[model samples]
Target: MSEENLRAAADAVLSRLVGDAGGTARLRVDQWRAVEALVVERRRTLVVQRTGWGKSAVYFVATALLRERGSGPTVIVSPLLALMRNQIDAAERAGIRARTINSANPEEWEAVRLEVASGEVDVLLVSPERLNNPDFRDGVLPELAATTGLLVVDEAHCISDWGHDFRPDYRRLRTMLADLPPGVPVLATTATANARVTADVAEQLGTGGDTPDALVLRGPLERESLSLGVLRLPDAAHRLAWLDGHLNELPGSGIVYTLTVAAAEEVAAFLRQRGHAVAAYTGRTENADREAAEADLLDNRVKALVATSALGMGFDKPDLGFVVHLGSPSSPIAYYQQVGRAGRGVEHADVLLLPGPEDEAIWRYFASLAFPAEEQVRRTLEVLAASDRPLSLPALEPLVELRRSRLETMLKVLDVDGAVRRVRGGWVATGAPWSYDRERYDWVARQREAEQRAMKEYAATAECRMEFLRRQLDDEGAAPCGRCDNCAGPRFTPEVDPAALEAARGELGRPGVEVEPRRMWPTGLPSVGLELKGRIPPGEQAAPGRALGRLSDIGWGNRLRPLLEQGAPDGRVPDDVADAVVAVLADWAKGPGGWASGRPEAPARPVGVVTVASRTRPLLVRSLGERIAAVGRIPLLGTVEYSDDAVDARVPRSNSAQRLRALHGALTVPGTLAEAIAGGGPVLLVDDFTETGWTLAVAARLLRRAGAEAVMPLVLAVRG
Candidate 1:
């Protein structure tokens, strides 16, 4: 087909698809104009809308416009499995022949390749990992090169190290397209991007030859129904208890964010003790498990979820009421992207943050994990350059002669450096281009340093948080996000649960037995693989502080510290605090607190604990599980279930009478969970972590219309 004639055919096909998306698919004037501009201008574009400002609409319109021009099939690269599935579903609903491919099933690659090459597909959604395949670059992409339409890179900020969620492979995308036929256009989109990431996209696309015109599309950040708030907790125990008490107050779906995988699991366990339906996700988990977690959250089968930075990338669940951060996030961009998942689907939402001083230490630890040493970076690049083809870690191990763990660390560092590529079965040398530009290597190093500095700044920012994010994401025209922590005062007020305190008061002197689970510190917790005998270690009182001290006295402090302070005390204790503590402990031990049932279920046996934390609402375990397994072709929801029997012991503690009195003293105020959910009042939905907005969708729908006027999400960070 002639180029001009082909372009026309592609355009026509896309228009037909757009028409099929229903009347609701029509883009607003501004959004339509943005899509037209990308097509007509042939330059880089940045679309920064609020959670639901028709960002997808802009991309869909752009996709149609490009496809109609007879450019063959357009490639839409996204980070989320849910996004790919949903986008494909939307395209099909709109009558577009949309197909997607990923690493989930190597067996299906041939069929997908044929579909792409035969031009039987209008659009193809793929993961960056999939694109790194030599067969992909040399096999399918070239088929449509002569007529390939628009290459839409979603979440484009991932290209920059400075981006909130940096994906090392994203930098290699431009390289993969280096051989594409002329006239093929690229459209990059992101809800959030810092100046550096936006510029990187432009530079990679060679847009406007160093003077690409960037567009700013703004939507209302002022969500009246979404009240923003922050919670400053002194310890983990009180934070957790507070979380348990407030879980039901959340509208429907929510997220709780923690700093580490261990923290995610710990927070989830504490919540499960109260009979909350929760699931967890982390990078360490198998893709199958993540798929299940995503499914549960989407179907609303699981009410809560705990996870690290891995849950939100491409997942989309719009009915969230709140997103909560259990600790401080690493950067403003990360925080913004994570919480942006809330208040989606035209419902009210909340973003909340609960930061402790230790948050800084936690962030630093994360930084140390990703920040590679120069020697490691250089060695990784050298090995990959020496190999003619992709190599797995085992194949390259002898080349480096480093310990397996150390080599893996170097590979991770290299992956972040964009110097390495992770193929389906092996790693490849993607950095030969880096060798030609030593300065680029230096730039990578310097950019990493700058990112660390930015992380520090984000953690310590005193200005309006929304403003900080706007600047970071290159939304220079963005005004103060009047809804965030920096623009508004603290939303989390110092309050207590009167009913809980009253209960505490009456139970404090009841002479209830204490279990290790209720201890101030979870000391002598059995290590993984140990059998549970329902035994408490000797000399360990089940009091919160003493237990913690004992755990710290031993080598188990790191594991117990965060769990103890999951929720800070509300300050309303009864006269017989001791009795209340014992009563609470006893209830927990006998009921939901059994070690076998204390944790939530997972697809596989728990190798260790994993966490899912968010800021706005309670975690969305069911929805997250559904999406993770939804990869391109799988229907994992309702097919998989989880078991929390991995937990070995339940820590129990006696509530001292004095403690009960203190708790009682602080919880007499109004606006408790009951009050907020009753009559017209504010109801805060809290979670441990939130990456994408999906986790908070349910809560937003349930609480926004009830007398609860507002839903807020406070999270530690947002993954890119």
Candidate 2:
């Protein structure tokens, strides 16, 4: 096809896509160029344009033109469910038949597969995760790769490990790209990527020699519609207060992003109390609820959705009016991607960042969960290589010390490296030599630390906020937008309503979080030298307990985190924290589930207190237990002592099996304490913090075996 013919075809598709909004919308010069590369030249292309710049339009238009030319369906590898939903709706507007194969639509996969096979579907969207699915990768993907007309990788930054939101599953795309037949145009798109990430993704796109090189379309990264600002709040309570006072004044419906799921829920509940129509959207939220929340936000029924990063990427609401961050994200690129969600279609949108002191602590917590040690990686490969058949994740769990999530992440990287393969039943070794790229991993870690520093700079910089963000992305055209807080001078006031502040303080200060005792033992505990499996006997199990707050909660978490963090000097519990614990105990007595509520199902009130001896924070734990026992006027039963070897044992931080193995024989009830608790009512077990709950479980079992009727565990905080 000639260039003129391709341009005309793209313009026609654009008209259908817009549907009389402006009476036959036409593609911009860049959009037309992208479409031309995909349809006319049939060459690979990478488009890095700002949000709302018709990136999706380029692909949909190309798909229409190619299908008209008797080409096969386009396969779009999308990243998020919300993104997939938006794309499917957009495809229909362009008169393209589109279907999705994602976790949410399992029931429709067969029909969608048939539609694609029969040439009835014009486009199909699949998540990067679906690319690694045993059935899809082994069966459907091969066929789709051979016949796909145009392959689209949305959110292409994810393809590079150095990208802000790197996803391991996306690395599988390299193989897919390598396997594509000649003349199949490939298009990768992202609104956020630095020079390094862009180059990495571009190199991947040019693989297999189908397209020796890719046409890179890089646009200026500036959102003129956004008026960005940062407000350094004193604490979480003040941040909530500011939102309660100012949310309605913002332009329209928007998003209130949080760093953690607990924060999202806490903010949502507080906003509801403040009479705002809002909902929490996080990875922990049910799919149906997420769908409903997205709809409510779309229809302007809710003022905002309090959300975590789960709400990031691919969610399309062109006129979203505002975005407020309760805590700063660790990377400027990630921050830019999230703030991009707003002001896409609207002429103006408010973007505010409320950075708290706890942000760095949260960043450090996440950093600890990064790629495992080289020894651990080698052990995983050895286990896989020794197995004759594919081993499922559960089966592999017993043989490796890594947690499920971290384990899966390692497997994905291995699969991408050709060291392992995901097969019918599970995963198997590929008998390929693989070496841990220590230097590359170290470089990635340094990049992450640099991004963290960049984020801090973003919050404190006096320059134009947009310019600062663009510079982080290595945008050559970065310049002051002359519309941000620094350039335009304080677009928003820092003053908050006094009543709202008090309410927020009250809500956050009144803390009592339920700590549900672990019931079922972690699977494969016996394989790690712990002779335990299945359910904990009812008699030996601890009753539902209470904690002052979660380490992830936006409320008391800020106060408790520092006190309980690793390497903190061990000392007596603070008076204020002791008082807070007393308050929690008072509430527990009168609460619906309390023992003193006189419900038949409730356990008896504690007749004594037993403290779990802590090797690290002995003073803190013992002081807390003594205070509780003294306040309740109950006998102070002696502590459950750790054996000499267990006291100095190095416990694994990765998996439940290792944690259980370390705690199996660690705690032993002293003979004196055993006699003290004999024939007693429920005992209150005190600890400074609960990480895996294994320590509490082991201590409770020992107490129960020593004749306590019941054990109720109480801790200062529960780690997320």
Candidate 3:
């Protein structure tokens, strides 16, 4: 087809996609070029366009044109459920039949598969995770690969580790790309990928010796409708207060993004108390709730949805009038992707960032969960190589020390590297010698740190915020937008209402978070000779406890995180924190879910206190225990002694299995302390922080075996 014919077909498809509005919906030159590349040239292409630039139109129009020519269905590998939903709706608008297979609609997968096999579906959307599903990969994927007319990878930046939101599952697309029959044009689109990420993804899209080169379409990353600003607040209180005061002033229903789930919940709750109809949307939120929240935001029924990064990518609310970030993201690319959610359709949308002091702390916490050390990787491979049969994640939990999530992530990476294969039952070692790419991993880590530094600079930069973001995406055309805070002066005031500030302070400052006791031991604990399984014995289990705050909470978390951080100098508990703990205890005595709230099964008041010996923060732990003991008028029975050898050989707090192995038989109760607590009322177990809760669990079990009536954990902070 000639360029003119391809352009004409794309315009027609755009017309159908937008219905009556489609008449005037002519394709941009870039859009037409992308369509031409995919449909006419039948080439692999990467469209690095900004959000709301009609990247979807490129794929949808190409799909329509390809299907019109009797090609098989366009298979779109989307990242988020929200994105898939939006794509399906858009496809329908273009008069194209669309179907999806994801975790949410498992029951409909069979029907959707049948539709695809029967050529009744014009486009099919599947999440990157779906590509690795044993059944789907073995049974449905091969057929799809053989017949797919066009392959579309939306949010394709996820395919590159250098991308801000790189996903291990997205790497599985390489196999599908390799398996596709000849002449299947591919399209990879992302609104956020730097030059490095683009090159990486483009290289992955290349078919080595077999496929033609991918046409890379890099465009300007700028959003004119967004008026960006950064408001460095004094604390979480001020941030919340600012939102509470200014939320009503924003043009339309929008989103408030937080860095953590707890912050989202807290902000949503505070907003609700302020009479704003807002909902919390986070990874922890139920799917039904998330769907309802999305609907409420779409219909303008809710003021905003306070959310974490989970609310990002593919959420479509064209007229969303504002986007407020309660905390800064780690990277400018990620920040752009999130703020891009706003001002996409409207002429103007408020985009503000109220960066918190704890943002870096949150970033570091996430950084700790990155890829494991080479030794750890080798250990995993060795364990897998020793196994005779495929081992499920749960079954491999004991054999490997990595947590389930991290383990699965490693396996996915290994699968992509040809070191392992995920079969029908579980994962199997492929017997392939895999070298640990230390340089690559190290470079990635360094890049992450650089990104973090760049984000900090972004918050403090005097240059145009939009330009800074654009430059981060490696947009050479980036320039001062002349509409941002730095370019045009502050669009929002730093002043917050005193009354609102106090209210926010009170709400956020109020302490006490429930610490649910671990019920069952981690799966496969028996394989390590721990002999623990099933539900924890009622008598041996610690009662549901209370912490001063969660480490992820915007309010108390800010105050407590620094003290409990890994390398922070250990000292006696701070006076302010001690007071907060006292408040928590008082609330625990009288609050709705408190033990003294007339609950039938609530444990009785503690008669003794036992401190868990902390190798890193002994003074902090001891002081906390002594303070609690004094406040409760209970005896400081004794401390759980950590064996000296055990302290010297302490294992890194990596995963459940490792923690359990390290803690097992590492804590011993003194005979005198055991007798003192033999018939006492419930005992208070004190610790500085609870990461995996394994330490507390081990302490509780030992105390119970030593004849304590019950154990109740009280800690400064709980890790989310």
Instruction: Specify the highest-lDDT model's number.
Output: 2
Error in Å for residue 458 of model 1 = 7.1
After superposition, candidate 1 runs with Cα above 4 Å error: 1-26, 38-44, 207-226, 285-288, 380-391, 398-468, 471-492, 496-720
TM-score of decoy 1: 0.62
Pick out the ten consecutive residues of candidate 1 with the lowest summed lDDT. 545-554
Per-model CA lDDT versus the true structure: 0.53, 0.90, 0.89
Error of 3 at 24 (Å): 3.4
> Could you give candidate 2's per-residue lDDT for residues 1-720 as a string of tens digits?
777776776787888887755546778889988988898889999999988888999999999999989999999999999998999899999899999999999999999999999999999999999999989998899999999999999999999999988999999999899889999999999999999999999999999853678899999988999999998777788899999999999999999999999899999999999899999999999999999999999999999999999998988999999999999999999999999999998899999999988889999988888888899889989988998888888778867878889899999999999999998888899889999999999999999999999999888999888999999998998899999999998778888889999999999999788988889888766656667889999999988889999989888998999898888989999999999999999999888968889888877889999998887899999999999999999978989998776645436455666677767777788889999998888999999888778788888989999999999999999988
lDDT per residue as tens, model 3, 1-720: 676776777798899887756377798889988888888788999999888988999999999999988999999999888888888889999999999999999999999999999999999999999999999999999999999999999999999998888899999999999998888999999999999999999999996577987999998888999999999878888888888898999999999999999889999999999999999999999888888999999999998999999988999888999999999899989989999999888899989989898888999888888888988888888888988888888888777768888888988999999998999879988999899999999999999999999999998899888988888888998889999999999888888999999999999899898888988888878878989888888888988888999989998998998898778998999999998999988888776656688887776778888998888999999999898888888889899988665644255556777787788878889888889988777888998888888889989999999888888899999877
Question: Residue 714 lDDT in model 1?
Answer: 23
**lDDT for residue 220 in candidate 1, whole number 0-100:** 40
| All candidates in order of TM-score, best leading | 2, 3, 1
Tens digit of per-residue lDDT, candidate 1, span 1-720:
454553444444445545643333334666665666666665455665555565666666566666665657777888877678778867875456787788776787788778877878888888876655557866665664556677778888787655667765576576545655554556667766655665666666663334444554444443344545666654555466566677677767777777677567656765665588987777766888887887888777877667777765556777766778777676666777777877776456777777655565555444545444456557667867877777776555434434345565456545544667676667876753543345654675566556546655755577765555556655646565666566677655545465543432222222222111222312111221123223333222111111111111111223223433335322212223323333332343344433235555211111111112222222332233222223212232121111232221111121122122222212211233233344543222322333223223223333333334433332222221
By lDDT rank, best first, the candidates go: 2, 3, 1
RMSD of each: 18.7, 1.3, 1.6
- By the lDDT metric, which is better: model 2 or model 3? 2
Q: Candidate 3, clashing residue pairs?
A: none
- TM-scores for all candidates: the values are 0.62, 0.98, 0.97
